[model samples]
Target: MKAKQLYTKPAIVGLTLLSSLVLSACGQSVESDGNSNNLANIKTTTLASSNLKFSEHYLTRDVRDDVFYFVMPDRFDNGDSSNDNGSKTIPESAGGFDKTSNAHYHGGDIKGLTKRLDYLKGLGISAIWLTPILRNQAVQGDSSGYHGYWPLDFTEIDPHLGTNADLKEFIDAAHDKNMKVFFDIITNHTADVIKYQECHGDGKPLFSTSKQLCEYVSLADKAAGKGYTPFIPKGHENLKTPAWLNDPKYYHNQGDSTWQGENSIYGDFMGLDDVDTDNPEVVKGMTEIFNNIISEFKPDGFRIDTVKHVNMEFWQQFTPAIIEHAKTQGIPQFFVFGEVYSGDPQELSKFTTEGDIPSVLDFAFQYRTKDVFAYEKGTDNLNDLFSYDTLYNDHNSSADYLMNFVSNHDVGRLAYTLDQSLPEASEQEKIKRFLLSNSLMYFARGIPVLYYGDEQGFTGDGGDRGAREDMMPSLTPDYNDNNLYGTDKTTADDNFDVSHPIYKKLAEYAEVYHGHEVLRKGTQKVIEHNDEPGIFAFTRTLKDHPSYTVIYNSAKSAKKFIAANAANHKVVYGEVNQQKNEFELAPLSFVIIKTI
Candidate 1:
């Protein structure tokens, strides 16, 4: 199915640029003498903190002040080939490490990620969110568990990735640098270890299709629990760790989900078994499991997987338990965000409000700005998205903590989104639009997440398997064939080139992000957006301090005027869009100005 059909946002995939906009050179630099690197311009004012509102969520400034780097372990780097194939020896046919296929593992492990901490820290990523590293079944079917989502054992790290000690070392090293490591955890489901008697062989399920046909059955239809007879595959009885998972009663055992209605919660996700999170036993067991995980690893946070699929009641109990346990484990500000792939603010905020999760991944941000960043849609779309920010403004959670990103493992990279929107656009134009997305996220309200390969400009085919590219080097033709922004090097070559345009620009953006308190913890107010693809702006201010107006020109041509009041402003980080004045926002560029 097409991404547009799957996601609520229609403009996400294959969006065209707003009719025939010309690509002009962004005029002159708007800097003053071109020698101002005053990264820390925030006045040391105790008065600002004193006048701050008593918002529990905003008082301490936690992950809201952070910039994150999201990584997939199997695609980052392979520091040790010894752990590549898990416990399987040399003759074990590369042990699922088939570098050529996008579906197979490529040997990037915790150790590889550990070795690259400097690379991440240097780029200004305060926290690292890695895809699930918990032990997977390893090669469930044709596709291997390279992405780390298929969990056979939740208690240990997958042997193909590394050992428990290797993970501890990685976290320890990250902490030593004052950086954080957040695990991508899942309570929604385990690997597809259970099979139903009704779906086997000639028995013929009620809704069997060419791919899968375990049709979703309601308990109301069959009253005596799961509609199908679920049994473990003969030899794989004890295959799953945490042993209690062996019971069929622990799972929903309904059927395959077409991702509609009740199936979204009970149905199997792409054949992976869906756990019955609503069950009291399951809730208690999952909480204890993760608590033990925190007790053992002592990591900073969790980026929960398939969050919306679980019942709200489960999260209400689970999230607070996890946080309190983490505090007991000495991680005071342990942040947790769930993955709810919806574009609606109401849908995303519900997890934070009723479910007790601190925040959910801001798919709404990506949906609203996917076009605005590239001038395909007006910035008014952003206004529409943020207009509902108060929907997330409960006492424990608010819009400030939403994990903002334009690109991700499931939705492709930022450059990929821009390139897809404007296929005929130049690489230079693509790079500017990419930076524009970063500029908004970096200086705007929520936490900005720099997708793993985005800094190196990895624009793969589109979402999912295509979006995942190897950072180390490639043996895959699908990855090698795609175009990388700024650099000619393909995925067949090492992409750790810090000299790349996107990398260097983001590094500078990081310095600016780190130095400014307003950009981090400030109250954001969106200025009026252009009706067409023109100047998009917002203001970030902390207490009584000087407010910085952030301006972005999404137009193909330079903006002649801006709606925001930028008259008494001086460029602090970027060049002004206007040739003479600091007020005008430039085309395909962004400027941050301090009110003088």
Candidate 2:
């Protein structure tokens, strides 16, 4: 295979409060902007993916062909600063834009995203996955819902981002360029409107005591006299849409969740009103709501939020309905994956099998291989990780569909992870680690999702607010103090530097990835692994196509291996250093060979 093109997202941070959906899952689409923000004049991408074309075998679109770029709308860009105040006179409804605080909105909207489509495309992206863009509870407590998680209205786009029509234009724009879009939806809970009097005293919404202190009372415990109750604030009873959400009967009222056993499924998420997913009315309502969302938005797929927190039965019913409904609406290839957040492969498999999710964010992939790439662990550790791939292989779901990522909105970035794990390491060493982590992700068996700002080498001090920096530029000290890869530019400066080393390096990798059908969809087998940091080789073979060998060196010094037919094989990436029986490898480097 010579070359083929396609697929790219930022991540979840508004992260979101979907409607009353528990265990709802969706899929990720791959994309980047073609405009490149005038980057055509800034610098020509040496391996710009525009020239690459997918083979005939992959002409039809599928989620696996995507490489999602997860973006938090508010932090990405500010195309229209006018809406930054949310077009409201009241400060509460305005969703305050405070560049001084990362917790507040910095005014990135759908318009900004629309303005930058070429930027993503020039970088080799084919799809876009934005964090919840649904109208949200603008101001929640002291923190703002700039990340789009606290949904005040699931029916509309947040005023701070743009109007619903603007979203349609953004989608239309992407589609015109042959890209897909995925909505990061939430169904487990809504914004924290339903509060407990037990925590807030006499229908008062504010409390000096944190809601986390409100002790949980399980349904079984409530049956035996230990009961916890919730109430709607006097004036705010009509807060939620679809009318049914205003009633207390629709919720579990099991108090806040510690994210432990019983409460994990039934309790509120960070005090947000948790939906009673097992209830019949709630189930039907959520199904109708998301189905309507699909019909209206016409997204290619969905990236469902908080699957594990919802009951399993909710998923068994919900996922199938979503897919079937999508088919009826003419979206036969609609994708649906969930956020399980667990690292155990066996437990991870359950969601795909019994839970009925199509795929899940590959947390197990990161957890299993993070140490190997970020730390000093042996390359052989990856064998144990890949061996568990079969666990996800079943009727409805397969390991191949898993959305692979090195870091996300909830988790700190690769830059931060590399620095934290190797605190004393040089900047170059950290860059090498970042590149390596992504290398494994790009060439691996799953759909690779690139977090927004990672290509710019954004170093989020940690996850959450720390990770959500402004791509346009920043005035925040917390973000400016941090270091970035390949550039001296801080968060205070505009970061869409096409000339940056990491960005170019990733573009090169994406070029290789999108160009090769086997690398994106082939079955992989470990050819060599060692207890020490050394050569880790694997074979990716698809039936009727030539087998390919992917090789890498995790060692600091050059490593040696032997490949007799190295000459016959076409070197797709990296140099082949051979001396009769042995070949040499650069530190933290890799090679891909299409074996004849």
The top-ranked prediction according to lDDT is: 2
- Summarize candidate 1's per-residue lDDT along 490-516 as a digit string, tens digits: 888898765555665676566567666
Provide the clashing-pair count of each candidate structure: 2, 55
The alpha-carbon deviation from the true structure for residue 484 of candidate 1, after best TM-score superposition, in angstroms, is 0.6
For candidate 2, report its TM-score. Answer: 0.90
Candidate models: Cα lDDT each: 0.75, 0.76
In model 2, state the lDDT of residue 499.
65
Deviation in Å, model 1, residue 39 alpha carbon: 25
TM-score of each: 0.87, 0.90
Model 2 spans > 4 angstroms off: 1-45, 50-59, 87-92, 207-211, 564-567
Clashes of 1: 2
The positional error of residue 320 in candidate 1, measured at the CA in angstroms, is 0.4
